[model samples]
Target: MRAHHLALLFLAACGSDKDPFAGGADAPPREDGGVIGDGSTTVDAAPRMCAAKPSRVVVLGDSITACSVIGGPNTADCVSKKVADYVMAQHGATAYQNHAVGGAKLSGIAAQLNAIQPAPGPALVILYIGGNDLSPFIFQSDQQAMQGYQMIEPMLVSVYAAVFAKLKNTTTFPDGAVLLTNTQYSPFDDCTASPYNLSATKTGLLHKFNNKVKSIADAQGADAIVVDQHPAYLGHGHHYNVTMCPHYAAGQTPWMQDTIHANVAGNVGLAAVMNGGVDRLYRDCIQ
Candidate 1:
């Protein structure tokens, strides 16, 4: 790799301002069969792929991290598909597991984690949730749903606290970190989403949610990946229809994955951002 490439990689692991989604020149696709933020720039080893000592990993969350396929198509990436595979390859014998379920409440997540196989060794836990439960509160116009998002705050904290507490008690999560993803930000406009995805109100709601996640980490003194990175990364932070949600909706075809959730390519980029981003956050948290 060139010096610039090395710097880019290092920055990816450190700099919060560096936006990988900001394509250099719409570069062409690589031979590896994945997508990039843009087609520009020379392709290299996938960030999710292993180049370092491998680590066992467990992912616990909602639909985004659970439902791995739609019909014949595969959706889960960071773990189910390439990232986990690569990590296994890089780490040289890493065990992996997914305990996430679609449409699950935080309560469900706690139970699922408890029931899943404990980590085999030094491992990382990717807790990619919040899209479903939070959305009801974010998009709901009715007082119940809207207010649900508000009260959902403490529910969320409880969930995280429970998860961390459990992980700490078990041997599975030793020195393992949580790759925490923030809520929805997309290209589609929520306000015009036929039923509002995010108006200013919902945006504020997420902002609060993000803060709560951080707060939980602070109080618990746990390691976590904070993805309040950028609105530009989540399709400029636009909201679309629920049915269009890749993590939730039953879209018409595999193509709809890109329209709603992160496509294979999108998730790969997400994995890159995540792998590097979380490592950065972990080091910072420990510091």
Candidate 2:
């Protein structure tokens, strides 16, 4: 919260430069989580028990969470909007905040996490990260990319722990909040696509990273849910044809507008993934 500390945050998070993964104007790619870049500041609020449904929905992470499209408003048909709209329609009451930055990596989350002001009732904090961390290494050799994953894995653990520590306790969420995190989904379609073929070792890293996500969420207990997005996105990538992907089926189309970011239909798919999680896991609290 100190001026120097804020300065340090920006510096530490500036390593990879622009968000290599989910590009587009999700708002100028602030790795600082909009702290000083966008005039956002931290807030303090008292904790309260959860209602029948979450009273607040806070979305965090990269452009995917912001629903950054190729040539449109970041919020246009984004996953966050879909979820928010669903909550409003189903529950009739909620406050939604999307603090996701376009080019953010896990490091950017510290500022985003710090900025959250807990309100009454349990909340749902949806996070999608790790893609930006892995994206830069894609063009590198297999060994180099794996090394990059090794370097970035610790940051993921650290950030995820900080989030669970801050938001999973009684002071922040009295009845326990629902934290949704996910594995990275590939737009390369298992390396069968052109121009972005990830080597076996590089593709393996995806699973490894996803497993780490699951372990971290598992260790944090039931309050956290690790939605597996990788498998869900497989058949929807660029090479969905039978020649490129055997899983390709009728009516399937590319979910991504580019090699990194999701399209409108993809965002809708992502929203559906989260919505299903809420319905299955939080059925007691939500209808």
- Which candidate achieves the best TM-score against the true structure? 2
Candidate 2 colliding pairs, count: 2
List clashing residue pairs in candidate 1: 26-39, 26-40, 27-39, 27-40, 28-39, 54-91, 186-238, 188-239, 190-197
Worst 10 residues of 1 by lDDT: 4-13
Top candidate by lDDT? 2
Give the worst 10-residue stretch by lDDT in candidate 2: 34-43
For residue 272, give model 1's deviation from the true position in Å: 2.2
lDDT accuracy of residue 63 in candidate 2: 73
In angstroms, how far off is 74's CA in candidate 2? 7.7
Task: Report lDDT (Cα) of residue 71, candidate 1.
Answer: 22
Question: lDDT of all the models against the reference?
Answer: 0.43, 0.59
lDDT tens digits, residue span 92-191, model 1: 5366677777666666886777775644455566676655554433223534544455455556666776776666665645444444444333434223
